[model samples]
Target: MAVSLFYRTGSNAKEWSGTFEELERKQAKLRRASQRILERHQTQDGLSEDDVQHDLKQQQKLDKSAEKITEYLATHQEKTGIKGKPVKSNITDPDSAKMITSKGTVQGYNGIAINDDKHQIILQAQTWGSVGEQQTLVPVITQLKQQLDKLTKQKQPNEHTIKFTADSGFNSEANLEFMAQSGFDSYIDDNQFRKRNPLFKESETYETEQEKRRLKRSKGRPRLFTSDDFHYDEATQTCRCPAGNQMWRSGVNVNSYSQKYTRFCGYLKDCKVCPLQHQFMRKPSIKTGRQVQFKNDESRQKLSYGDKMKVKIDSPIGRRQYGKRLGAIEPVFGNITVNKGINKFTLRGQEKVNTQWKMYCLVHNIEKLRNSLH
Candidate 1:
């Protein structure tokens, strides 16, 4: 058996009822109520000192309400802190995160699923509050491994080679390295995988959208000189800026993620004299010259899992195998989100939300089994 495993993000964008959203709604209501309460106590004529004191007490009440809301935001959900420093907790679903969907910002858990290519049966389903999908791959695979082990114990051969297919969201250098170490044959699309194929380049749609996105990000400002604008000399181990000024290798360093890069900087004399100084450098005001970083060959090899996947996925065999992924996974999401009307999760905590998701996946598998038998 080919034993294809397809993984995908679930479709339902959970309706955000987080503490932040709830707080805004509650604050608006409280403001209106407080205003009415203050108006009732206000004197019709010019206010006396007693009237002023009463108004101050009413204002104090409003301040106390706001203070209480702020305290709740600060103190609530201490155990499961929000990612990238705690800002505000979701009052309704503290475990869920505010994710930016195509529609807009949504407070919800990201639902993940793994499916069998044979019958489109869901092998695993999980819910995560993290907006990033990079961290979820290992967990999903671990769960699937356990399930497969159980099946092997039931007399099925465990020697079959398993191949995984997923979209660009699950792609990462770390994940790719993990797959190689674990002996998994996975075809995970990188963000730029499509650009490698001649067909995609021939098509104007990708190019057009890319230009639009680039223009949107640039916001009418002239595009600054990127690293691509510099020419490298492999023999000399030097770089030349777009203005033809030679740059010396400043230093070699590795980032927090262990990615290595070499920095190049032009002489202050050269950069200061260059006409393209403003076009190339972001900091011409400073006395320093222009700087650029180039990824070394070792670094490229270490982090080019996406690039490797591009070569694999561009092949006819690769395309045929990956073609099965969408069909295997998307139908289940459609069934759960669209057909079953599970547009939003009603559950609260992560455990409960996960259980609820599995229940729906179970329903989907049962339906698939029923249909196959018919």
Candidate 2:
């Protein structure tokens, strides 16, 4: 049996943008304004009592709004153990976090579901408040084990070997290791798994040179020669430009993204005298020279999980097994969210949201059971 999972997002109840300290400062300013309004009622002979009372009432209303903000901060601060910039928790549904969907950025809960391959019956469902779905794999598998253990005590269900498949989002080294240690035949895709397949060899089409020139014209900037326009020789540690000029190694740089590169530049005299300088190279003479940066391979090979998964997932048998992942789990989410109209979660807290998620999955499984009986 193929066991698979995917994420279904929930809607947000409210939104908050700033930090807790900023909220507290606004509350303090409101209190001071309220005090100043009452003091003006006692003094300032030109002012009438009615005007002073009206100002006080307006300030009081603002103070009440600040009070509500303070209460929300207190509740969320206790709930989320970690706090950092662009504070994550929503004001109304404190348990939900900000997630990016196809529509836009949404403050919501991530609903995870595991389903059986035979009839697409949901076996387990969980809701999480994390932005990324990578860490949710372990918890989903643990719940699946417990649910299957309970079923053994109830009755004799179909006995079949369990197989797991998921998308690239769940393709970390630790996750792959845990799946192996748990003794399951798992087929998880890495980020570039499909690129490794021989079937996609001719799928990549490059932009025409005329199209590239048109883009340069629209941008209102002179076309600069990029690194891809140069040819590198592995046998001889050197690089040559499109004009057949050998570029000398200028400098080495360690970038912020943990990648190393060697910068190459042509001779100043050669760049200044070349006819193609304005066409391919930087036109300005003060600009050092035609520069190109080549990335080193050391930092790239340090992580092997991507390469390892690519080899496994590119196999013929692996493709056949993983093809069941989307059909197995995605229909369960579509049935609950689209067909059954349980798209937006009505609960506020984490525990309540999780219960609602499970209830929807249960309803889906019951419908599957009813169809099988007929």
Candidate 3:
């Protein structure tokens, strides 16, 4: 499956950005305003005064309920957790999600398209409002299966013939296990896949000229120690800072982008008096000490579905099959987005936006047909 994000017509500036504290304050202010209106009417003496008093009492009761909600919100602080961010819903299109594209973060939808490798024709396409693609594999593949059955006029479509290959974005343990159990040939790359490739072996060395100029610019400056400077022993499961002080293991396994890493932290006491602390630490008055993370290497004997897929994708045959993906789907998207100029959706709401994306895919297929007749 080939997926991409397209920015729509909304901006973060248009979004009502605030923390839980701010929201609590706003709710409290609203509750106070309601109370004032109720109190102002309570003093009035006229016909239906009983009804007015009853209505005012009900309003006050509603305000008290709102106050309870605000109180809960006020006490709990909003935090940006690891691999988390402030979720903003746009006033214009509430269904659109906040996406980080190559250009930058923008309000958009993730449009996914599965293409026929032979002709690079879109087999199935859909748009989702979620930022992550990991959860989309099953639904998209199920749709593709239905489409394949319809087009091929086969009751039982040869699932073996049609292999599903996707990028790392769709790769999850569940997804890999699904593909494996369903007996579908697949290839999905891992984060460290490129490290195995010889093409990037001299990648750092190729930028030697740039590095020399950078070093020359900061000739007298001492190079600050980074996470790489920290020594970690896998056998002992121990970490030591650059100053030769043993650090405490803060977290056993921290997950990021489907990869696990062990987190280590230095004690403030140890970091405070270290002679090389200034060289490694960000600041002298820092609350905490240096932190380092080392990638976890799970045992091959106990390989998970994701780990097995990683090994498969790094294979020569897997690389060859996966290599066809860019040509199969990318140019089709590039021609539609760049050549045909159908980049962003001009509609609002999920149904409308999804319809527009499918229409674009249909247009691309039509163009392909037109070229084929010649």
Q: Order of all candidates by lDDT, from best down to worst?
A: 3, 2, 1
| Candidate 2 lowest-lDDT run of ten | 298-307
Clashing pairs in 2: none
In model 2, which regions exceed 4 Å deviation?
1-13, 17-58, 71-87, 153-160, 202-306
Q: Per-residue lDDT of 189-269 in model 2, one digit per residue for the tens?
A: 876666655466543311446645665775634344556545554345576554445678877674736777877888777
Candidate 3 displacement at residue 264 in angstroms: 44
lDDT of each model, Cα atoms only?
Answer: 0.65, 0.66, 0.67
Q: lDDT: which candidate is best?
A: 3
lDDT of 3 by residue, 282-336 (tens): 5783688888787787431233666556545554455677788777777887888
Per-model root-mean-square deviation over C-alphas: 16.9, 17.5, 17.9
Q: After superposition, how far is residue 132 of candidate 3 from its true place, in Å?
A: 0.8
- Candidate 1 local lDDT, 188-301, one digit each (tens): 776766665436756453357775587588773334666755555555677665444557788877452566778898888778765556567766736778888877664342
| Model 2, total clashes | 0
lDDT of 2 at 285: 57
TM-score, every prediction:
0.57, 0.61, 0.56
Clashes of 3: 0
